[model samples]
Target: MLIIPAEKSLDWKNPPWMTLALMLACLVIFVFYQGKDPRLLHTAVQHYLDQGLDRLEAPIYETYLEREIRLEGEADRRTDLEAFRETVAAGERASLAVTMLMDRPFFDYLLANRDLLMNGRQRQYWTEARVPIQQNLINEISAYEAGLVPAEPSLYTLVSYQFLHGGWGHLIGNLVFLFLLGFTVEKALGPGRYLLAYLMCGVFSALIYTGFSWGSKIPLVGASGSISGLMGMYVAFFGMRRIRFFYFLGVYFNYFRAPALAILPVWIGKELYDYWAAGSTGIAYMAHAGGLVAGAGLILLLGKGWFQAREAFHEPEQEEQDRQFTHDYADAMEALARMDFTLARKRFEALWRDYPDRPVVLEHLYQLAKLRPDLAEYRQRTRELLNQYLKLQQPDNLLRTWQEYLELGEAIHPLEAEEHNRVLFAALRQDDLKVAEKAFARVRDTGHRELVREAGRLLADEFGKRRMEPKANEYRLLLKTL
Candidate 1:
């Protein structure tokens, strides 16, 4: 299941540079910097093997495991220790070297006994290989050095960890939320304030995680906590205003309108529930919950006094354009109903100027023109009405309009050749023989040469389809000369 606010009408006129910069920073770090992790890890492991540090450490680890097993008093842990001894005996020391090196407790044990375990030359190899690998490639690599470690939390890592990711999946998942949720919050708070809010949320999330996981070496990474904070800010920024939300429940999905602040509890509850219920999922749900609350708290502290209302979540209660058109159209019709021809024409002409394609405007204006042909607008109005009618895609309807225009006035001119081409093709498609034959003649005389030939071929096929063999033969024979 997933849910999010379906807001953010992008205005390219004002680009969200902060949001874009944050995204670009994460992408560059992941692609060019963190992308080198696999190779670096391989080098570290290779260094451990080349130094033959495993041979020296393996028995020490074995003895440590043996002693630990008796004190550990857990069957599963004892089995694991016995399995470690079997792996060492099987001579898979290269892989085992990494485990032993990363094992901080065992490394401390090995350090305590290093003098007894190795000669001076062996200690030289250990120092040469292990130090560089452990510092740069193992624990001090990109995720660790910069990422938030609850055991050793600092201001630098609290902020820096938001940029590091464990893998591509982790980076992409967090970024999608950032883009979907960030732009609106940035727009709402404006960039300067939004950046401050975002970092503050991240810092607060790290602080919360530190409280939960105190004195642990594992480094927490990813932008999820910051993204979660944006989620919180989204709710608190908008307050009680109704906003559209999109939700997906596996096979089904839809959009609905609800108060913006209503979803905050659901978000916080889900995060806390997942943290307590799902056991250890490698996800920092507590950080997410903390970020959510912190984000809202920041808004509560500084939002109302700081900024105007939220533009991001606001939806139009009524369409201004459609409402205005209806009101203006009704006013015009009311003037016409009172038989105020002068006022009616004025209203209609204005409507026509704005809404040129309104059929009722054409019908009434044409009638008014007939009553006052002395205005000398009848010819132009007739031509305009006929042109608009021709735009109707239905050929039958166009033919009916053509018939009405002809019946409209004997003095009215037929449409120009380019315009007549539309009628000619419409007549052909609909098999209106009387109109098609006359149109065929007009186009043959004044229409485009290529268009005339193309229409001639179609006219011939249309004739054959009608079983008018003699007429089909006549046009088909004429095409040979053309």
Candidate 2:
């Protein structure tokens, strides 16, 4: 009986997706109005990527004015100079060819699909790319104004460049995690608030990422920071829900769930451990930490209510009953543990009557029923308990429960085939021959064979009673094959 109470209804907060869309639209409009077309920026980026891709495939040009070194001769000096110049010329040609081949295709693709890949292109990209760039660009602009900047503005980027990825694997890995974590907090917090929360967390994560490598010129690409933020929020919003994770565990597809809160320590501890080890193998542990902190902090600030919501149990009556039952059960077990059978018997006797139908209570009663068999009242109560248990238990559970009773030195009921025959009859009547076979196999008596044979005869009679002449005649032909 799983009932979701009215109290469990989701908060009617702002929708994150709608808010993200609207906010992004305004940002784009602002950029557009300021003469900075997003399409142009995307095109520029695409061109840069295309240039890299072309260089990968382009043939390197090698030219040489043959320089045969004549030891101790004037030809050595003259030949070396010509060779050096040709080598330089060839390098220059190769660079130009790669750049030219890449620039056109990348820009052309961007121009053709700017609308598709820009605003409404990939909703995830906004969080992945734009948010990090916004923070870094803002910081760069601030530093530039203060005149406290390096002499040459770097074309090789750092934090802002982490959003750009080369291939489908690059984009998909980041996006999948982003959607998984982002969607959870987004749905919980609602759209509008969720967008702001996402962006804010992204910026915070970026600052942390950059803080570690303040002057790094290499481009760091991916939406990992934003995704980390969502993970942080996940811990805050849904602390203890079990999330099943998939990972290789010695070659078997082993399954397990981690409480959301417990998973945090694992992630944070791994990052911290790796950072301390100084394993600079390209993973930005700093960014993950930053995003984690931002996500956790932001959710705590904005969604303090989310934590409280989880603590709340909607069915007060059921919660009270369960709590009381637990306390009583624990006390009785403790008495049993202390070897005070008399006290345990008294406590179990009282609790058993209250929850006579409960499996745990009935089990306790059955265990005590043997020792106190002289108490005729207790013995009668045990019999009634067994009868009630058998009625509700499934076949497998019935078999197990009955055995448990028998093991307790309780009298076993006659193993009647009628009890099992009812299930067999129902299965056969529904034309479920597989279930009939399974059910019939469980019945103890050979007398049950009559019921099975009767069902088979009834099925055959039904086949004879079919109204369709073509089907009936087809059956006759099939009977000849049989």
Candidate 3:
């Protein structure tokens, strides 16, 4: 699930300078600096294998994993350890070497057992190979100085870590949240204050993460913490004021108006739940939570009035009208789901009468009208929806509507060949032979002889592929007659 402020659109006249700079910086670094990560990682891992580092470290790492599995006895980590072992046994030399090569904790483990793992020649050779990879490769982009290492936090790392990202997906995800929240936050706080607040939030986010995972060697790198800060500020600056938010529930999506503060608890609660439930998932949930709290706190301390609304934002011209319609549409759908046909019909017809542009409203009204087929509304609605189905470009919805219309025994009064041919073409475009056959059969006796023949030809080929040769020949005979 994802939720974001949808109250404002970008305005070219008044731009968010600090926000754009931050986005550009992240993009530039990813394209230029972190762009080298893939090559550097490949070269380092290849060298590790070329120097036979795997043979020495593989056994030691296996021993280390076994000890951890036995000592910790956690179900999840045990699964991970077993999976890691499978990679080792599969002779995935590059992948196998990379675990120890990039992982600081494994490096420390190897250091602690240097004499136990390697003889003099092996030890000297491994050391000679390791130094360059650590200094020139890892230290360049993923340098311990740039990534936030909880075991060894510094003022420098706390601020700098927000600029590094683990992968393209990671950078892109942060970039989206950065833009969504950053533009408004920067506008509210001004460029200087926004930059300062962003770094400060990052600092606090790291501190909280360190407090939870102290002495852990994993280096956390990403702008999630700072983006989370902007989220907090977005809520605080708006406070009890209502704003539009776009939300997704896996499959369907919609926008809702709610007090900005109403979403903060949900955001923080999700992070808190993830912090405890997904402690080993490598995502710093605590840091995200910390950033949220810090951003809100800073905004509150400065006073809400100090931050202003985005005057340059492009609010939708139809927003006020759409809000009421959005609610009514949801209510009408709910009535339909509840099988309250009377209520559903009334509400949808009202919407159709008022908003003739809403094609979906016609679809629902047609569904209701079919039940009362003895009435004039049934034919009126059938003709209305058939026109809409032909004009609309959504093939999936069109096919479904036609299927439902046929199953419901719907027919247009004085059926027109042009409409039938259009529906047949639409169905054929989707390769929906079922609807195409039904629609073509309606227009086959009419003057649309060429269309019938072409459609029959396509149908014959489709049936041939399905190995229904008799059905294929039936259409072939029809094409010959046409």
Candidate 4:
């Protein structure tokens, strides 16, 4: 199952540099630093393995002696104990075959030292005991040196760990989410606070993971924990706003529009379920949960008013454009109110040219077109307004605007025939004969057979009832031709 937030909760005038930089940094670290050297890692693993094995030798020997002394009382067990002792004395490193001969106590001891022995053997095999390892040791060195090991938590690893990822998929997945959620948080919190919050959440995530997986030697890496925090911030910031989301479950996919806060429980529940069902599947769900909690808590403490205040700082260019749009819109409205067609037309034209997407500009322009005596410009502006409304993809606005367009007696394009037919059908159902008649006339020659037949039938029935014989007969003949 996959769920992605569709609409950006907040819009930014300029590029979100903090979000972009974070993503780029992750990519660069993965591609350049982490992917550079395999041998160095192998060597480092070998080195640690050898060191660990040396530390375990005394414990292994002590356990062996204890087991030998215990087995000496039994004649049959004496032979096994002697054989085990010989194998150990032969300086042969622990192998699966040798470990199999061990009793419960000895086997447990062997298991305790398994990591060191296995790593040592793997390193030795890969390195062939060769001297002068290559210069590319960054990847190997970074894992333990920079990456967070839950058993050995440190201040530096808390931040550095977020940047390290296990593979390409890990890196890409985290980066994608980071960008999706981070930019919104940045837009709300401002760059400085956003960066600080991100790092703190990451640190908290690491701390949470460490608490859960205490003494675990495996290195915890990736930005998921921090991004989870951003998700939390998102929920806190725009939780009440209805946000659209695209969801997929295997072959089935659909969209849902719900309050942004609704996603929080879903995310948290999924993480909790996965964490329990799939024990330690390399994902630090706890860290994600922790980050989410931290982010949400931080936002709550800062209060909603803080976010509103931060939003006041917009890019200068966007602010200037907004100011200009307001000034021009007001001027145009004033001119229209004064019935100064020349000045009003000029201002409306400039507004439309500058802000084509502004629905209000189209509405005013359409109004201006109606007041002026220029039939050609009136028709042109009416078409433009209709087209803009269609492009907006707002169903309610489209219906309202289309009704106005029909009332104005302007032509609609063939491309809009299907939608126009729907509006016509709605108008007819509502018993608005005038609008229905106007819409039918516009779509009559568009070659929409079913729509034309339906319109002809409706128009004929209505006209026949009104005792309009000529109009009724014309519609009947039109239907027969179809």
Which structure among the candidates has the greatest TM-score?
3
In angstroms, give how far residue 391 of model 3 lies from its true place. Answer: 47
lDDT of 4 by residue, 450-476 (tens): 888887898899889989999899899
Cα RMSD to the true fold for all candidates: 11.2, 19.1, 17.4, 17.8
Name the Cα RMSD for model 1: 11.2
Q: Compared with the true structure, what per-residue lDDT tens digits does model 1 show for residues 410-434? A: 2345455665667787787776777
| Number of the predicted model whose lDDT against the real structure is largest | 3
**Residue runs of model 4 more than 4 Å from their true location after superposition:** 9-13, 44-140, 305-309, 312-482
In model 1, where do residues sit more than 4 Å from their true spots?
A: 54-129, 307-482
**lDDT tens per residue, model 3, 144-256:** 64788889988889988899988889889899889988887876777887898898898998899899889887888888988888888888877898998999998999999
The better-scoring model by TM-score among 1 and 4 is 1
Q: TM-score order of candidates, best first? A: 3, 1, 4, 2
Encode model 2's per-residue lDDT on 20-121: one tens digit a residue: 453344334334432233344444345434434323222221111121234433242354345445545676544443333322223333345545545673
Off by over 4 Å in 3: 72-76, 143-145, 304-482
lDDT of each: 0.78, 0.51, 0.80, 0.70
Question: What are the runs in model 2 whose C-alpha is more than 4 Å off?
Answer: 1-167, 240-243, 248-253, 273-283, 305-482
The positional error of residue 169 in candidate 1, measured at the CA in angstroms, is 1.2
